[model samples]
Target: MGKISYYTEEGLNRLKAELTDLKTKGRAEIARQIAEARDKGDLSENAEYDAAKDAQGLHELKISKLEEVLANARVLDESTIDASQVSVLSKVKIKNKKNGAEVSYTLVSEEEADLKAGRISVGSPIGKGLLGKRVGDVAEIKVPAGVMEFEVVEIAR
Candidate 1:
């Protein structure tokens, strides 16, 4: 069963754009490569042909996977998301208990998860621990190192 993916309006648009690029532009590029390989020589012992076929297979697989994800995607209403507590689409501020360091992250869909952009996937360790938490609440997350505590400083939509 395909899991439903929740996404913001911009996120959904980005996914759609990616799907289009993969299906059209990507297909054209791979087809060109395949044709070039085919023109090289006899197919019976063509390593280039084999490599092209493999690459095409990979490209098709990626397209299929993205299509499946798009089929099950559900756009989230950002306005409906509560800023009172940490949840999907919520920007959460947390203070690391051990280091006294503070970090802010926005919980978003896996597709939109970018650490450099401060967006984390809901399934991530820190994200999971932060979910459903409110301001001033502490979440004890278990990592490979050990259990680390974090205090929820704020939450925003």
Candidate 2:
């Protein structure tokens, strides 16, 4: 079994929709391509047929992976989240100890992470370091550059 991952209701719904689309429209498109290629005749010498077959294999693999991900997904109720400490779905404000810069990010599952929107994955280095930490606690995180220190300024749901 795959490891279980928690997601917000919206995130889980989005994932389910994507899986449904892949299983329906995606598979239909691939099947259509294969049918068109086969109509060319002489499958042994048709490069289009070979390419279509390869594409179908890749498409099925993607569907399988998506199914596995859905199987292990667990939706978490946002109302139950505690704001007293850093955790998934918590919007946390932190100050960089080195440069005195401040930024806020919402900790989310890997599937919901969008850095441009200030959403980060709890599996990330900084997120992991901040997990379970309360305001006024310092988190030391190791990144590709080096170890950086950040002080938790606030946590909110």
Candidate 3:
């Protein structure tokens, strides 16, 4: 069984839209490329045909992987989540113990993690360390730089 990953409704919808595009427009483009390459010359000597076939294989593989992800994906209900501790979908504010730098991050699924948007994957090192931590709790996270301590300052939806 595939491991279940939780997502927000918007995230799930985005994935569905991408999958639809891949099955429709993406497949159509690949088919067009293959047909165009086939018209050029004999199959044995056609590098373009071979390349198109390879691209089609890769595209199909991507679609299959995405389908699997969607099959295992579940939409998380924000209303049921407890705001007292850090967990997936929780927006948490943490302060670096050494530098006193504060940053807010929303813990999300690996697929939905966007550092630029302040969304961190729950599977990440810092996210793992912060899991289940309440306000005022210190999380000792082992990052590439070394162990860094972050104090949980606040937790919200």
Better of 1 and 3 by TM-score: 3
| Candidate 1 vs. true structure, TM-score | 0.96
Q: Please, what are the lDDT tens digits per residue for candidate 2 over residues 1-157?
A: 9999999989999999999999999999999999999999999999999999999999999999989999999998877877799999999999999999999999999999999999999999988999999999999999999999999999999
Weakest 10 consecutive residues of candidate 3 by summed lDDT: 78-87
RMSD of 1: 1.0
**Which model scores highest in TM-score?**
3
lDDT of 3 by residue, 1-157 (tens): 7899999999999999999999999999999999999999899999999999999999999999999999999999998988899989999999999999999999999999999999999999998999999999999999999999999999999
Candidate 2 Cα outliers beyond 4 Å, as residue runs: none
Candidate 1: global Cα-lDDT?
0.93
Clashes of 2: 0
lDDT of each: 0.93, 0.95, 0.97
Ordered list by TM-score, greatest first: 3, 2, 1
* Deviation in Å, model 1, residue 15 alpha carbon: 1.0
TM-score of each: 0.96, 0.97, 0.99
**Which of candidates 2 and 3 is the stronger one according to lDDT?**
3
